[model samples]
Target: MLSRSRALPAAVLMAALLGLSGCGDDTDEPTTTASDSAGATDSPTASTSPSETAAPSSARTDFCAQIPKPAIRTALYGAAIYDEAWAPGKDADVRGGVHAEGAEFGCAWTAKDGTTVTAWLFAAPVSADEGATLVKKAGAGCEHKKMRAPGADAAVTVQCISDDDTVTRTQALYGDAWLSCSLQTPGILTRLDRAADWCDAVREAALV
Candidate 1:
């Protein structure tokens, strides 16, 4: 089953870069792939198919499992509200289903209450804006205001109210590749604003 769990913090970025490939159904989870100038093998994800998630040989060559530790730490440092970063711990191998040679990267984020949001970065790239549109269509209800970053290969945000007390913000990014972030918590508009602000800051800082 698709985890159905909350996604990470950079989905808007992914949708912008990967196109509409990753959007639509939450059940049919999407993977991410990036092209590095360095000549290295591309790692696979449980959700990536041989055709859909595979980057051209010239685009991405390195296969180390997760984004570099420094990259995640940099993104966390950029976040306005949180001062912590997610470190790459281990590389777990996965096979079958979506693609071959799949792997998972462990990561975490600091919550408002100072608790850590332990998560994983799944390496599977889908179409740009797919995550944001799909999330809005399936998850909490909210109104999309405007495009956050222009000229960005991919960038978008959606605000939704799951209930009277909860608001959610979903953001995605893509430079040479794609990344996504989803914030689902309990609170009114205040929490959503803070989360969106933090995500925007991190996105700016994390860019190469």
Candidate 2:
């Protein structure tokens, strides 16, 4: 029963164990400074600002409906699937940060082997700067990299490997909404590559 509060710190520790260094950048890709990352962590709940509370009336609220079952199966490498809603009041409690307040929608799929893939969608009135800030915050300490996603103003992929498991998180910002998907697998599994694909699938369905 991994909770959201424990996910980011584990990823940070994994980055240290793997000897990974600071975040990288490319001319054509979005970049963030160590200062930006530090600032994000200093204020984890910044996404809950008053402006965000005034999200557009049409902001999406049914994120689970946007995900395709086949995508989940493929992301898990054909593992048996048990679909579960990860809302605030559900059995699977997702506490901490913006998630603690309540996401527009959240879903989790558990593989037969106990691996889990979770996706959360939060719709808010996000500016470009705010979106970038959120991505950096979510990706702190992991090997964060830029990604291209349909309908996304900004996108990033983060990967971390620990002795017991590997965690991959993909995040994208589409207009006034944000979508994030995290995959946790046993050992140093190469299934990390599939994180982007799963995220793309959801972005295509939910945003485009």
Tell me the TM-score of each prediction against the true structure. Answer: 0.40, 0.65
lDDT of 2 by residue, 39-90 (tens): 1121124333426445433235555677777888888777544554443222
- Please provide the root mean square deviation of candidate 2 (C-alpha atoms, Å): 9.5
Best by TM-score: 2
State the lDDT of candidate 1 residue by residue for 61-132, as single tens digits: 222223344443343333323222221222222211212222322223433432222222234443444433
As a whole number from 0 to 100, the lDDT of residue 137 in candidate 2 is 59
Candidate 2 runs further than 4 Å off: 1-44, 47-59, 79-81, 88-101
**What's model 1's TM-score?**
0.40
Q: 82, model 2: CA deviation in Å?
A: 3.3
Clashing pairs in 2: none
After superposing candidate 1 on the true structure, give the runs of residues whose Cα lies further than 4 Å from its correct spot. Answer: 1-106, 110-122, 126-142, 164-167, 190-193
Question: After TM-score superposition, what is the CA distance of residue 149 in candidate 2 from its true location, in Å?
Answer: 2.2
